[model samples]
Target: HACVIQLPFNQKVRNNPDFFLRVIAENASCCYSMLKAKNPGFTLGNRGASGMFPSEAAEWLCYHAFTVKLSNHKVVYKCLLKPLKFCHWGCFKTGALAVLCHMVTVLANL
Candidate 1:
């Protein structure tokens, strides 16, 4: 399942300034888990058209995106390693290649 959150350009977010960032920070793990369950190999892509927002809002969104990506990587890394502890070097190589492929896909999408 894909989830999309649309925040209206409203006075509350404008007044609080960091509200959007705070929300993302607090929910990053939840979002990551939800998406990961939907697709274990989930990769984060760029925020297209995010530049259209005001600089402050756009910057905050970028920061939030960074945090979410970091959180997602942490979860994915842990999951990837869990079953590899008993595996041989070849499995490690395969896991590394998978991670590289995921990174390349993300970059390509950007």
Candidate 2:
């Protein structure tokens, strides 16, 4: 089973980051419960930009630990630095590079 959650713009830009994390965790838990009831052996996979982030990663880890009882699940963590084709836009290149650099720094520290 797969699902894409579209959070509201206001919620995404909320002052309290924990609020958005809580929303994601609550929704993910509900989905996991439903899917687990239907099939005990089902594997849960997370994709897209959110999958690579720390908050979502924590939520997925917790879900896997409590529900699936397994720590190994495939998560696609794509680099966000791809160029846009239609408009020839390189606008977000700097931001994407920054995020990639920051991720490398964090990983190196760990």
Candidate 3:
């Protein structure tokens, strides 16, 4: 509960234990990585590159916790949703991604 999630920007910037904003990256490392690709250094004022991606991350956290897929669980939702003024994005962005679609359709069709 006291751990941090480092965002792509934060990861590239070297190290800052505040990127816990990863709850927003939504396990989408690609997007997360791309979002911080432009700014390859530490964040300035708010430990973020005054841009859309960082804001997106913040916005995501306001309604979610951990970089897991969206769910109907209240506890999970609220946890992921709890907004942190700032956090690390690199942590949650590290794991592998699961296929989000239902494979049953393809299998049944086959």
Candidate 4:
């Protein structure tokens, strides 16, 4: 239950006794998606470190991408992690469709 703090859970997961597990799975999937997007060459699926913290990875990846200083022949790490806002701007209409597609696929298999 230490993982998967946030996700778009179904009403079943949100209202039922299996809420925690559902959350964990959603959080795991989010982590998996982000890692896959960032490091496409890495083969990560149902396998990962025994325990992976999304917040920790989120902080690390955010810093690595947004912070750190790069200059000619020089790279420096300030090692400061900032509190981040969970905001995603721009239209995500297509993303919603992708989610719908995946949901349909899952339901079809079931």
Candidate 5:
């Protein structure tokens, strides 16, 4: 009995973390197209200029935690979904992200 099924995006993004991020990017009202491509950097706000490819983004999110990189390679959908904010973009009015980023920054300085 499998507890969860994991499927990844290739050519199209749908019904996953990438889908949610896409919807938020191409929201009918806004249509800012925030996610340009899946690269290796932040994919939101002005910093998203160097957007991440979906695959890379998922890997980065899953591996990069508390500024430490994990050795796991095979990532499941649920893992990526847990950390993403479905409708939220960047740190805009998002105190939690701001705090988290601040914490990481402070820790890096130590």
Candidate 6:
């Protein structure tokens, strides 16, 4: 199901980068927390440390192309797309279809 939705979500982000950035910025706390938890070091601040700040993370997610591995390890960090898609799917399933539809309509109008 996630794989099915990923393509459209990726295209949406590509088509509306600014809109997706705003959406991500609105949920900055969630992004920050998740990133901090995943990378407990200076990874959030130092771009040289295979690290990415929140905005870069957002941009990477928008393009569906971020592949920063942990320092000296093979573990690839999690992408924001997974959680975002989970939340979206959950909302759509839990009586938020109208709201989502309205969002789609708004996006379409843009």
TM-score (all chains, Cα) for each model: 0.27, 0.27, 0.21, 0.25, 0.24, 0.24
**What residue runs in model 4 are displaced by over 4 Å at the alpha carbon?**
1-15, 45-110
lDDT of every predicted structure (CA atoms): 0.38, 0.36, 0.35, 0.34, 0.35, 0.43
Candidate 3, 20-82: lDDT as tens digits? 335344444444554566666734112232332343343344333442333333343343333
For candidate 1, write residues 1-110 as lDDT tens digits: 01112345533323442444455444544553454467645343323312222222223333334544444545423332322232223323334334435556887999
Clashes of each: 0, 0, 24, 0, 4, 0
Worst 10 residues of 4 by lDDT: 82-91
lDDT of 3 at 73: 35
For this target, which candidate reaches the highest lDDT against the unseen true structure?
A: 6
Native RMSD of candidate 3 (Å): 14.3
3 or 4: which has the higher lDDT? 3
lDDT, candidate 2, at 22: 56
lDDT of 2 by residue, 53-110 (tens): 3233333434333333211211311111111111112212323334435667998999
Q: For candidate 6, which ten residues in a row score worst on lDDT?
A: 65-74
Across 58-93, the per-residue lDDT of candidate 5 in tens digits comes to 223332331122113224333334344332333323
Judging by TM-score, tell me the better candidate of 2 and 6.
2
C-alpha-based local distance difference test score of model 1: 0.38
Order the candidates by TM-score, highest first — what do you get?
A: 1, 2, 4, 5, 6, 3
**TM-score, structure 1 vs. true:** 0.27
Model 5, total clashes: 4
Better of 2 and 5 by lDDT: 2
- Model 6 lDDT, residue 15, Cα: 56
Error of 6 at 74 (Å): 37
C-alpha lDDT (0 to 100) for residue 32 of candidate 6: 52
